[model samples]
Target: MDLIHRRSNSSSTGRSNTYDQLRSSPYADVIYDTTSGGEYLMKLQIGTPPVEFEALIDTGSSVIWTQCLPCLNCYDQRNPIFDPSKSSTYQDLRCNNKADHSCVYDLVYGDQSYSIGSFATETVTIKSTSGQSYVMPETIIGCSHNSSMLGRSFSGMVGLNLGRSSLVSQMGKHMQGAISYCFSPEGTSKIHFGSNAIVSGEGTVSTTMFMKKENHVFYYLNLDRLDAVSVEETRIETLGTPFHAVDGNIIIDSGTTFTYLPASYYSLVREAVEKVVTAERVTYQDDDSLCYKTDTMDIFPVITMHFSGGADLVLGKNNTYMDYGEGAICLIIICGPAAPNFGEAIFGNIAQNNFLVGYDLSSRLVSFKPTDCGVTQDIPIDDNSISAASLFQFNIKFVLFVFVLSLIRL
Candidate 1:
């Protein structure tokens, strides 16, 4: 799948600072401004005649949903709401003969945004880079009738997580439980599934991927230590507390914006950063994030995250810091909970920019390889493929979503 960045209408060429760009942008929202909430969007065609629509690509979520016609309550969207009556292939998934046997789903996000709808199946079509259209019949989807707080740029969301109802799971043997995506800092990117998703080349590092019985949606990886040029290597267990390293510690999530570490470990990392950075210190009043007033991001030190099995991910300045407008830049890594009750630690997408990340669920391994994501790459299709079982082309659009700790199904 090929991905492209959706550009804002506002002119950003002559802006002296990020602050000016943020202020001039029309899509700026209260949550984190326009730039911070950016996410990748993909196009999907549903039903017999095919109603094409753009959807946000979320790795944290599982269900694929789009607002439907006769919406009792819904947020404004760029595309027309999907009308099931017009599609010949659309069919509601009825669990039983009961009057209320409609398979309904209620998805609530961390920011209190919600989507309520009936589960259904439809013929979905996605075009590959080779101009080949891959069709999947009877694909599970959520036809949302009520929704709130969704971005106006996209008509729906395409979830790429490891859930039973997800597109990957529904594809079953066709996808072979494999998926991979490469996110560029700007311009176009690509994602692969099944045999094409394999990441085995030079400079590629593989780490063990484990899942919790309670939550299978997230992809968890183990962190051995962290290293900076000037500071000593900091290990997770040495933080004056009992840390669980065997059960898989941090989550590598594409939906999240910032990386999160335990408070105590985060403090150590912050202190190490403070020692290396020579720029004038500043404070961001909005989130109190670690900020520095600097003209260039080059002053920031590179961070090396050592994961289990010799996977050392080297994070550069662009991966570790975010422009907080003005002359200030803030670290994208934030503190989560502390000690005994340590909450979920997340490895966000900012640090994943320019990397070809692959998840092979069958092998129970996740691999990473640094690459120039901005360049266009051909979608590698299997030559022996007889039918269009699983293939999707996605245009990457940056949209942000605040994840809730729990996904509530009502």
Candidate 2:
């Protein structure tokens, strides 16, 4: 489960958009979204009057930005663009303004997608799972004037990372530096912030997070190895090599669709999985998927991802295989082409289903507990109507097991 990947935080101009989060009152909420299997979305209400904006919750990217008014060739969006003129609380940051505004930010993605905008601060609100409206004022955000590829599908993106500009990092002392999310099999998921984000129980497995100075925004994990188990077991070790180390070679991102592994290592994993399954391997001319025509996935082996600190993620048939329609089921794990100077694995959201994954930045630990995410888990509210001591609870658990991780950067 040891992961290794190169950092892609630089822009075309060689300038890094290092946005610092403004210290403010922190509050937790559960944002709900029903997205395609590719990515998770969040319903957020920003500004003073609180206009609704649907954002793609991305852990890989930092800086929560949205399209602003006076567009300079903006994308085709379905939602109404955010107009700072309408909000009295909105303030545009100027490069020369020393009072509060610091500097303008320019962002560029690894895929060459870019956004240029001025730094701004405004009030952001979220509807908590407790049915209470919580607001965080003076929140730092990017009011983009020029953005690429971010059109009507989403108004903007909410950054949830360890970076200074990330939503979690900006929460500061208001939140206990913890965040968790539970994704259902039906593609409905909810994100929890603050103290309630902690995952505890017999099934919860905790692992130490590895952080590197160069890549501070992304959350890294110590992936030990991967195991393919059917009648016989096939093992692929990811650590103890110079390529894999404590600095963290693997990234767990919620926005990515499939788990990516390096080509060479993935070949070994695919061969092992193919040997254990009796279904015929089918290849499409236009698609890059390892698929088979099987009525059920039980014929395939269960994959276990073993990580450092004894954290094991046991992936069942539902978590490992996906239906591609027309009686074809494809494996969710993908083998990516080898990149020079980078050999890291990416554990995408597809592989994280049916589990309550919690990230505690203060303790530098990531905890995972298997649960029926299809069932809703509500947070306890401190209200007189409901006694805090006698709050409702559920009995869900996880099996501590591990699987192999493919080392792929992109």
Candidate 3:
């Protein structure tokens, strides 16, 4: 099989200051994120009596975990658990040692935990507009015995491995084209699989190539023009950084709802942002991230993000800070675990709101442009890459570099 290769900018230290995480996905009728602000959903089935439920489509994870009947520790579950004993088609994919990412394991979520198992082959059915039935075979699905509110209401996760294994792929065995992701943040959405799989309305958008490696996704930013005037002390620079070549490894994460930067770039951003803001009244939420009181910040620094295809992408206030249940977002600076390491940033959901995002795996490219939602921005349109006539199926490959190690932890 032939593949598209991407280049990277190197540093004198030779240490890779990049963050890329990969997960695997496989299921039937499994539509990845296909809604605006991503309110995508999928149909799910439980065992024995065969319980069917509608679930959210998640690609930021690997295990296709779900909640099932006999759920020992399920709590405040808004939905019914799957009755595995009643389902005649349920089969287990012993989670002990399996490469299909079907090995069962125990997972712990905030204030809740559970046992997870896998299914190697299962029947997944999806419907088209005319009620057309499309099914997936031998799908790897995860079952959560000890469940919680987070697992019960949702159907299951669809991991997006590097061009392989996904709920969309399993269903694609019976569909028309590649899967695309369309997400927005209300924590409620649907994920579509196959042709016209991932869709949104507005048609005015552009395209560019993405930088990927191994099983990870890397993205590019035209840093040379990241700022209109002086951002901080030094001129925003990416003269020599990983994935800085005309083309290299850059990643966009649906799961990681924040922007991450390499150590050096992180430092520069912090230093520069600090120079503009005063030390007093500066709030410290976490060690890795930071922001000053918006009122105290100096003249709003114009951050100019240069995209590959000559697109000028910009971030609204929400992109820099999260509400954290508060009414306002942090400004002047946002923090990731990297604090100030390299010179790269990982784009997260808050930053991607309403923007038309396109990732073309077939051509190894990713692109983004502005959008003016009824309440979001005043901008005109939000469209992205690919063509309906050509059937664009860009296989997204994720490569997880390290645990909280080199990545900018939000």
lDDT of 1 by residue, 1-410 (tens): 42221222245433333332222111101011233266666677898898888776667788989999989998988779999999999999997755789899998865567899999999877654223345668999999999985455567777778887787777565456777777765776656666667788999999999898887687889886332112334333433433346667788877666788877677777888888888888978866678999878888877778777888888777888888788989988887752111367888877888888988988889999998877777655435332332323111121111123233321
Cα lDDT tens digits for candidate 2, 1-410: 32211112334323232220111222332333433335567778889798988777777777999989988967866589999999988987666655555667888764456778888989888755334465768899999889875323677778898888888887775576788887665535568777667778989999888777887678888666432222236676654443245556678887665777777667767887888888887764457777887767777787877777778778867777887777788877877553211445778787887888888887888889998877765555433233322332211111111112222321
Candidate 3 lDDT for residue 254: 53
Give candidate 3's whole-model lDDT. 0.45
Off by over 4 Å in 2: 1-37, 96-103, 110-113, 128-132, 150-152, 187-189, 225-232, 239-243, 338-343, 382-410
Give model 2's TM-score versus the native structure.
Answer: 0.78
What digit string (tens of lDDT, one per residue) describes model 3 on residues 53-160? 655444434455566666666544445666666667777766545565455556442224334544445655544322223334456676766654432345444444
lDDT of each: 0.71, 0.69, 0.45
What alpha-carbon RMSD in Å does predicted model 3 have with respect to the real structure? 18.0
Sort by lDDT, top down from the best? 1, 2, 3
Q: Count the backbone clashes (under 3 Å) in each candidate.
A: 11, 25, 67
TM-score (all chains, Cα) for each model:
0.79, 0.78, 0.60
Worst 10 residues of 1 by lDDT: 24-33
Error of 3 at 380 (Å): 20
Considering summed lDDT, which 10 consecutive residues are worst modelled in model 2?
394-403
